[model samples]
Target: MDRRTACLHQANAFREKALADPEHHDQWIDEAIKWLERAMEASCRAVITMEGDDGSDAPAPAFETMAPHRRVIVRQ
Candidate 1:
C-alpha cells in the first residue's frame, strides 16, 4: 500500500485500540490523530509531486525579485 493508505490504516488501528482499552482511550486517540496527520502529509506530498518535476534547483518567482516595498500582483 502507498504511504497515505498505510497511515490511514494505522489511524484506524489506533481508533480500534482506543475502543478496546477504555482506560488509555485518550492515548490511543492521540496516536490515531498522529497517524491521521501523517496521512494528510502523505496526501499533500502526492498532490505536490507534479509531472516533470525532477527536484531541480528552480528559479524564484518574479515577485521575490521586486522590492519589498512594492505590492505584488498574483495571478491565479
Candidate 2:
C-alpha cells in the first residue's frame, strides 16, 4: 500500500480499537491524529513529486487510481 493509504489504515485500526473499548479513547485518538498527520505529509510529498514545477509534462502517478477500501467489521 502507499504511504498515505497505510497511514489511513492505521488510523482506522485505532479508531476501531477506540470504538471497541472506552478505557483508552484518548490514546487511540492521539495515535489516529498522528497517522493522519503523516498521511497528509505523504500526500504533499506525492503532489510535489508528481507535479514538479508544472513546466514539464508528466504522467499521472499510480496513486491516482485508488481502489476501494475493504471495510473492517468490528464484532461489537
Clashes in candidate 1: how many?
Answer: 0
Score candidate 1 by lDDT: 0.74
* Best-matching candidate per TM-score: 1
Per-residue lDDT of 26 in model 2: 88
TM-score of each: 0.61, 0.59
In candidate 1, where is summed lDDT lowest over 10 consecutive residues? 60-69
User: Hey, what RMSD does candidate 1 come out at?
Assistant: 9.8
**lDDT by residue for model 1 (1-76), tens:** 9998999999999999999999999999999999998887766541222233566677533322322333434344
- Residue lDDT tens for model 2, 8-31: 999999998888878998899899
